[model samples]
Target: MAEKKAYPLRIGADVLEAMQRWADDDLRSLNAQIEYVLRAQLRQAGRLRPPVPTPAVEEKE
Candidate 1:
């Protein structure tokens, strides 16, 4: 996992309340919901790279 940085954000009260409701509906924390929304937008805009898949390990019998 990568280290995370904390920054203060200024959001309108109505927007924050709406986001809180959305986060609850999605069973995510407010911060995580915000990140998810931003990541989705970045992906849509071709600004973020797609995640690479890991190779599956073989099981020895």
Candidate 2:
């Protein structure tokens, strides 16, 4: 997981309420909901890079 940086946001009350409801429906925290929506939009707009796949590890006999 990436370290989260805290930044104060200025959102309208109606938007915040809507986001809270969405987060509740999705079983996610409000912050996570906002990040999820933002990430989806960024991916759709090709503004964010795809995640890198981790290499598999070998087991010792």
Candidate 3:
């Protein structure tokens, strides 16, 4: 498994509350919600790299 990287993030209370609400509504963890938002913004800004394909899983009896 890849090692996880961590960063310290600072946000205004209002913005944090809004993100918390959105995360809850979407059934996503707060970290995931933040990542999703950041990824979308980066994509829109043309700063995103090409996506790598994930391996497919097979079902067994």
Candidate 4:
């Protein structure tokens, strides 16, 4: 997994409530739902690039 960064977000109460409901319906956490929505929008706008896969490191015995 890539390193996850944390940033504080400010969302309007009404918007947050709607997202919470949607998240529940989609069986996703609020944060994951938000990211999913944003990623979809970014892809629609041709602004998102495919993530590069990280190579696995072999463990030394």
> How many clashes show up in model 3?
0
Instruction: Please give the RMSD to the true structure for each candidate, in Å.
Output: 1.0, 1.4, 2.8, 3.9
* Prediction 4 TM-score vs. true: 0.77
Winning candidate number (lDDT) = 2
lDDT of every predicted structure (CA atoms)? 0.94, 0.97, 0.91, 0.94
lDDT of 3 by residue, 1-61 (tens): 3466999999999999999999999999999899999989998999997587889998998
Best by TM-score: 1
Superposed by TM-score, candidate 3 places the C-alpha of residue 13 at a distance from the truth, in angstroms, of 0.3
Error of 1 at 36 (Å): 0.5
Candidate 1, 1-61: lDDT as tens digits = 4588998999999999999999999999999999999989999999998888888999999
What ranking of all candidate models by TM-score puts the best one first? 1, 2, 3, 4
User: Per-residue CA lDDT of candidate 2, range 1-56, in tens?
Assistant: 67889999999999999999999999999999999999999999999998889989
- The collision pairs in model 3 are none
